[model samples]
Target: MDSLSARSSPPPAATSPFSNPKPVELLKKVIFAWVQETGLPASICVRVHGKSFDLHRSPLISRSGYFKKALRASNAVELHQEFPGGPEAFEMAALFAYGSRLPLDPFNVAALRCAAELLEMTEDHGSGNLCEAADLYLNQVVLQSWDDTLIVLQTCHTLLPMAEELLIVSRCVESLAFMACMEILDPEQKRGRPVLPLRTFSDRPWDPEAVKELAGHDLWIKDLIALPFNFFARIIRSLRRQGMKEKYVSPVVVFYANKWVLSKKTHKFWEQEDGADHAANTNDKVSAILQAIVELLPIRSQDPDRNAEIVPVTFYFALLSMALSLNLSDGIRVNLQHCVACLLHLARVDDFLLPENRVLEDVSFSRELKTMEEIVTIRVAFKSAENAEVVAKLWDLYLCRVAGDPKLGTDRFMQLIHTVPVADRETHDHLYKAINAYLSAHPRLCNEDKARLCSSISCQKLSQEACIQAVLDELMPLRLIIQALFVQQLHTQRALKDCSESFRYMQCGVFSGSIPSSTCQLPKSQSPYDPEETTPVPLEDHLVQRSEHSEVEYESTRFRMQALEQELASLKHSLRRRNPFGQVSDCIGSLRWSSQRKYTNRMLKVFRRMSMLGKSKSKIKQRASASGSLACRSKSLNEMYDC
Candidate 1:
């Protein structure tokens, strides 16, 4: 045979070129000279993805089984179908077939491998084929290095089923998983120890020590962010199988989702800028990414042993927001919603204020409200009082924010308020403020709606200051003001009734001779009620001083009760005569309830102190006067009641 025919002939099966390397430089020079000669033109044409290559059929058929079979029927072949790595990869294969060295690196190795497989360039056709050469380089060089494995795995995204069938993706994932698990389990690895030589395709030099020092335990996590979601999930599963803890795995998952999924430009509910088909396509892609991320997330384990570190509540909210914006599967949406609801107490008011793209104006708050309802129900079921209060307060603040939107209707506003159970709120201060905010914003709301909105607020739960403000509020409905007034009256009446009973009990204790008379004479300057009197009194004189103080408080309470009766009577008459729609500030301005409240509080304090002072002596003459004082106070209370 001629030198060309001998060089191009397939070597014997036992003597592969990979085992005993051949010097092909002279043959390459001869082939180049032959190709340049004008008298000897190329014999065949190969077309791929609109690009054409004219070449001699001898070298192509000898190197590639696919070409050897195709050229049997004709001299020209048209590859109109999609190629594995596009035209660039096929160019490399063609160059390799021509006895030229192929440039193999982590970035292009996976694609070249798939392209070689597509061309059926196996050892059956030649001594050492492109497919075998690519596989050897990938296993020995690419998978052995930390950074190269990631680069090759990323390249595998463009080479789908071919790369998958060649097990290139699985090999890269296994390598990454093993490295990550080692970094987590081995303390030496955690301290920035380089496991393999740091070599990468990029021009930028990486200092493993610096990265380990800066990223600490999360160095592997930071490196894995460039991987596509499908391969990323595979790596995560492999890591889990290797007994890697979820605490280390969760942050990277969250980071990946944030980088790829949440950062995408989502279609707004009201936007039709993109055509329906384009929007639908984008939605489907985003939905797939989101679902994959949710699946890779660690299931919130109830078992303490299995429980790992939790992903941030903010990320869950963000995921849920994105999920809602797209037309996602119900299962994925529900999973995200449940995750958010579980950690709802850790959420902030701004978390619920989802972006405009996610929130439909027609159902502005329905999704959030539904999540809150779940939280409320869970908290109530578990009897988690502290968390219940937290959720309640959070909802109240959120309500205050949304209440100002004139678009928020009464039913929705009321739904938000009532979503939290009545028992969860320790005080109605927040609820009352939220209601006031809603009423102020929607001034055109009819009286019945206003009344219904305010009805959720319990007058009994209002602080004394809030009650006073509510009474003076002109926007308050007439019935609510009356209820506030009635609550105030009940408080005052209870205080007076207790004061009168204490005085009568003490007078009885004295008249029944339960104490000695000698201890009843207290000096006038050392009364316990005097704030400035620091001098200590003997136990008996303290008792007599308490008796005197109680008698004085009884007289004061009796007079206050009479004043309250007159004011209440006046308020009732005013309500009956005045227009029901009139402002309450006009009627409440004349009442001195602020001062009356102060005095009533002071009298109650005196009564409480007198009770703790112990039953003791008063002289018979003083006791008779005390009895007369009690009788006169009791008579005044009865007369006021009758009036």
Candidate 2:
């Protein structure tokens, strides 16, 4: 009897090797043991995507409204509908129904939430159901943390209709938009800890500090790029609706495009693969995405103070290239072209050299050419000479690169060349180079075609080196070479005539004593007409002498004018003092004042002409120096021609 009592008397209060198990732990163990039991077959068979799961009906029906409703009809149940989160998520739900711990994290949280919703796990079914628990975890933890939110959002892609039906996608997108705006709009708000008194979305002035903060902390942008394009577009639209500045929003678009749309591997695959339904479907999806991105761009922002370029010119070119490849709508193409033309001055030469799409090679090239034409037309309409010149240089280099393509025809090439006005370019060196490239590439072209190509090149605008090169080029027609030589001779003659006139003016000035002899002296040995013997004067010396002489003359004339003014003032004072109410003094004072005004006006005109003449002489001197070099080069070319 004592031994029996010892075995049953709580073992003399001795501790077991393990501590006492908590109630929750014990419950988990019992539920897991029951689930693992093979002694009794599962009460229900749940089918998901051809896979079946044997689950007990008691725990499932108790915890899930969906299970309870389905199991009411029979003991054995077969699910014929699609399941959110797949079998793994369904298993997790089943384990939770059996009083097992449901592990909630960013990776599985989104799927579990959708699955719980589909299974109708809610407060009505149980006190703390999977749906409510998931909602708590997502709102309190996942959505609050930026990185976790991105992770969960990525998982939502697989659980579509239900995820959308449950507003998980919308919640994630709105959270992202809110956080992004908070980051850029009010940087003082710390991450993961949202504060109150949120800034309202109004038309506020540009904030440089916020932009700086955004530039420094762009990790959010990197996190967002991995999200599917649909979610990304929603976030961008949310940002826009929240009145986020374009400067803050555009970079996100660019980074996303760089990853998904502009990747060479992806673009090449899209271009090369054909005749497959999957490929066609993918093309359609990508086209829609691209169109959405284009529409989301801030190209239409009409804020007058928003002067900065929100979208880069290069990215616009990229979009245009993709648009051409996909054969997007005319409206989209036209809008893109307009944006590009408006910002054409900001484009680089490489921007125009779009990657060739071999599938639509001709169509793409022609469309690109049309874009160029549109840019030129818009720029020329503005009548901004500076922008015109920039466009001209860009087109010239672009033409040089494309001229080597064997398929580029003369008509198309000439059409591109004529897009820029002839007067826009100050020098045709780049144009000549482009034309030479074309001629070299198409060696079999007839003389008429060559002349037509060369006709756009103005001989007068060609630099000295370009002129020499043109004269020596064997591809050049005889008529062009002769025209080039004749133009050079005419330039030389004009320069010599100007120089002779300047010398004669200087000599006359010195003889008339208008200019000091020492400053205006000309060398007796130098004759401007004799080009062979004439030596070019250093421009710096002439400028220095002219400046010094002008200063001296101005100072002397100023001194005389000041003395005359003082004398006039004294005479007027004496006339007022000596002849009070005397009409004669008044008449004399008025006459003197009129004469002084006329004399000052005449002197001002004379000084203006002198300054003008000095400027003209300097310009003539520059022309003369340039013409001397051209004359030497021309002589060599002439001798070569004779040979």
Q: Which regions of candidate 2 deviate over 4 angstroms?
A: 1-62, 98-101, 184-217, 265-288, 301-311, 326-332, 354-386, 404-410, 441-451, 474-479, 497-501, 516-643
Candidate 2 local lDDT, 291-343, one digit each (tens): 88888776655631241244456667777787887889988887877777777
TM-score of 1: 0.68
Quick one: best TM-score, which candidate? Answer: 1
Candidate 2 local lDDT, residue 463:
70
State the lDDT of candidate 1 residue by residue for 302-381, as single tens digits. 53122212355666666777776675777887776666556667667677643363344533355555555555555456
What are the lDDT scores of the predictions, listed in order? 0.63, 0.64
lDDT of 1: 0.63
List candidate 1 segments past 4 Å from native: 1-30, 33-63, 71-81, 86-103, 126-128, 186-219, 264-284, 299-309, 327-329, 354-386, 405-416, 442-451, 486-539, 542-550, 578-643
lDDT of 2: 0.64
Worst 10 residues of 1 by lDDT: 12-21
